[model samples]
Target: MATSSNFFIHTFLISSLTFFPLSPSLADDDTDKPVVEQLVDTLSTIAGPHPGIRKNHAKGIVVLGEFTPSAEASSVSSAEHLQSASTPVTIRFSNTTGIPDIADTNPSSFPKGIAIRFQLADNSYTDIVSISVNRFPVATPEDFLGLLNAVAASGPDTPAPKPITQFLASHPAAKTFVEIEKPAPVSFATQPFYGVNAFKFINKEGEVNYGRYQIIPVNGPEYLTDEQRAAAGNNYLFEELPKRLKQNKAEFILALQLAEKGDEVNDPTMVWPETRQLVKLGTLTIESIDPNGEQFAKQTMFNPLALTDGIEASKDPILLARPSAYAISYGRRLSGQ
Candidate 1:
């Protein structure tokens, strides 16, 4: 018996709203529909760039956090002991809404976590990253910035497009984002960050397969509320991280979320229902810690493009634009302005 599943939730069906310029030579409209994802070709007129908001975010870096994934099977370590077979690990942790100096105690900020690129032993491909953030970019680069600008912006609809600064002032959520820059109730080391990608796994049998990586905090992921913010004050967030690393072993496991075909391609808004099942890939425990000074922070770059093989990018759009922007930003920092 054949079965049907709509799976097309509004958030996921968002691809329906995106525009992709395919080769116009298609014989007919029916033929023009994409086999992977079906979206309206007319998405351009309905949409304009939604300029994402950026607060010239500046935090110090860890000279120790410096390590890149290699195309070969290597190990993750420092000047001393070498351990686990190292894959390229591009990790980033940030509060979605934050200014330079704010308390790290706000749950709404969703201290964003990242570990984009990692290599497999043979290095045929890379593990996909940001399949969770937004979807269209994987389809085309334009969607990443396009959809972002739309969501974050008030747009050209006004008699005059208000400067983003003005629009953000009107939108309280935007302001709250900056106010709660580092809102971590306890220590950020406790939160569980996701690697929202449906990876393609293949075997020597010429068969194809799929999966994703999961990072579970061994001890944390504490959430802070508004009331907690008034008491904690600004330095509280920065204070908690090192305290956790010092008091507890503060470790997280890297696991995999294997996938079958056609999981919810719609509601790009919800997390792709992971079985939440995890397979142990590696472990990340804060060993030697350092200060968040300008030298360590300013010089670092986190680009999604720099991945090792075995992991593959999915048919999502937002994940597409990161590499270019990240590389440019990385180069700018290295240039030492």
Candidate 2:
């Protein structure tokens, strides 16, 4: 239903995994290839439906100064920032691995990555950044090989018999994050994790530092139920987006959580919880979008690597993988320009 480049972060990486885990055949489920195979097949189908969105798929992963936020939080009050929200923003949302011609109305689809840019006070812009629903780095570039293994190990559609228990089956390093260890259809209820790939900070004085960001859904998190996900609509948000955004506004508040220094490095599999509740940084609202209309289909970019000065990225491994793949796909979409 959506397409973008800043939105591109998930396009390349996620589309690559529309597969089941690899494992010896289960009695009734021994008919599929490695999960990676299915994932690739699924993506090949959704990668080319929207013309403009696809064009945007052809741009830069992230340009250093284009849209980074200040290194530190500003003296600007959160209230002021919220009040300043009058500055309207336009965003492009798209499923990175959706099948071509897929119906946006389906609930089983993967989340469309989000790429957002704001017109700042100085008229400068912020680089596009992707906000994904899945927080676990299991899907990040850092977990590539291991993720492939999970899909390789399990059968498609067969939820690992013992989710928490099976997740523990992979052993520590067998999987990138605890998430992938989770057999099939990780629940949004129990596992709403983020790549926490990269981030930037803003100082009231306008100083900036690169950083990482993640969210822990407010409702203890829940994944789509079995029936709602039948049409490959494994995740219900797929069905919810069109409905909510059409009703005037769609909003998701993501508190900002920064990675403290001296912690793990390039460890995309790590999890940082509410032990440090996210700093209430901002709220994302989608005023309204015509799921199949021109504006949503054309004119929106969403490369997660895109950013503003107050939000620079780091040399984090997963963060680093974005530029090339993101740029190529985004460029192809924007090439005629």
Candidate 3:
């Protein structure tokens, strides 16, 4: 039951190695120690050491919901959640950066995040981690680390052509990402989220297709104007969410945009043509906020590679590194770092 057809008329939208396995349940290995440590260190430097919170996307609120698959979904993937039965889901919407108290109005928070955990039978689950930006700033974990290092080094007296400026100058993709217009949304419920990385969707017939996720608000996007944004409170987005949920449930269309032949399925920095095919997967209906959401979020870790059967990670370097990087953050959060 998709609405906002006119809005659809307007827009459209990684695998692993043993050392860098594509599984989220991976334990800490010696090989990944340095990379994980470096990422956590750099993020801490950028955000100034926030403990007991995520190293990134620390400012988030969790909610409980459900996902009902479309009939066409089973044709695209044999994933259990894509079957006839509806599944429960845990959703977290957050602003970017590790600053837990950062104001929702801050520019750095523009590219918001939405992480979804679909719970299946037998204590298993899968997750979809996406951001508001259509494409990522970098393709590999190394480049992302470089970007973070540059930001951490650039200060008021860092001079013209600062470290971040130099990084962006040599990295055109990152420059494009930074230059993207990020207007404030009226609420997270009104914003669309894009999965920058690609994954392989395989059906029971063994047919395969590489695609990314596009989660659209069924009510369409509505943003605050300049004057309204200027007058908004620091916690405007956070406060608006529960009240909006109180009035009625928020709904989103969960779809996948299939990649055509010759498309770069490995590099997140690359954007697929909007003309790519969009497949209906399901509808995610968020009925209410979980009373224990805050406490639960602190303990729950949402991993993109936490895949179920019928879904596989593509060979995207950034995608391969996400679980390890997130694990370090989760570890620290558990230890109250």
Candidate 4:
């Protein structure tokens, strides 16, 4: 029997063939375009061009922290970075979409992002990047571009059966991703974050496991009520985080959701079943706001692919394409474009 998800994908493919058929030459032309450039172009269409700013998740705050691996973490990895020791960290929390001044209460800012750079014991560094949502809208880079294109086509003068509606009618996962209501969080520290991409983790005994990373907030998950959302300031998250840090340290547990033998390791769109086991890897504690927040935000480039010996990225096309897309954004920022 076909799963609902499988049926959806099959139906979507058939609908796409009928409504948006492409010639062989057109398909080849699309394949020839760089993923990074396509990503930037898609973002520009959605949010308008903002030179020198990130293509998405532009509004953010930078902070300083430390990561202390759990006692059990060392058993899983001989990597010096995983040893139970205090490692300095640079952390940034941001809202989704490319609008730099978007209000925190806006629905477009539903899936917030967290990026952390850990300065390892060996004087090297690694980065972990995650978002509040666990599942992605599309499986592949091409599908993601198509979703963006659909959004771009639905302008003020768009006729009935909007491009996004047509796209959603075919793509069930993307439809679900858009339809899901992600309420506003009370503060960045109160929301749980998930590393949507799968990664291979190697243990000291050379045992390798595929899993996605999760960051569970020590403060517990909290959200703003509709009334609270209406009353909040445009930069509530930005204001709340620093004020909360001053009152008490913010913390989160780092965990891994291990995949079963048959899990889809390369498709971020397919979330692993909840029955999978979870291993607590470490704790991340944000002690204070960075005094030089502006400078730190400007200088830091948080790449998800920056990994140590124990961890390696999976073959997910979206995961593989991130570094290059990030580099394009980073270069524009550095050149003051």
lDDT of each prediction vs. the true structure? 0.38, 0.40, 0.79, 0.76
What is the TM-score of each predicted model, taking all chains together? Answer: 0.56, 0.57, 0.87, 0.87
Score candidate 3 by lDDT: 0.79
How do the residues 1-337 of candidate 4 rate in per-residue lDDT, one tens digit apiece? 1244333333232222111111212223555557676555545444566777766677889888888888888766665667867789889998876678988876667678899999986778899889888888778877876765565455546676777678888988887766566778888999999988999888889998888999999868999899999999999999999899999999999988999999999998799888899888889999888889778777778888999998888999888888887887677777765
On TM-score, the stronger of 1 and 3 is: 3
Candidate 1 lDDT over 1-337, as tens digits, reads 0011112111122222222222212233544344212222222112222122122223211312222222211221121111234443334344432134433443323334443333334643232233212222222444322333433232334333333344334544333322333434455566565554444444333355454555666654565666765678666655666665566555666655555456643223234464644455556555435455344345444444444333345554444544544444345446542
Residue 35 CA displacement from its true place in model 4, Å? 2.7
lDDT of 3 by residue, 148-194 (tens): 55654555565666676788789999778765778899999999999
Question: 40-87 in candidate 2: lDDT tens per residue?
Answer: 323333454544344222211111111222222242222223233443
Candidate 3 residue-wise lDDT at 60: 86
Poorest stretch of ten by lDDT in candidate 2: 57-66
Give me the displacement of residue 317 in model 2, in angstroms. Answer: 2.5
Most accurate candidate by lDDT:
3
Better of 1 and 2 by TM-score: 2
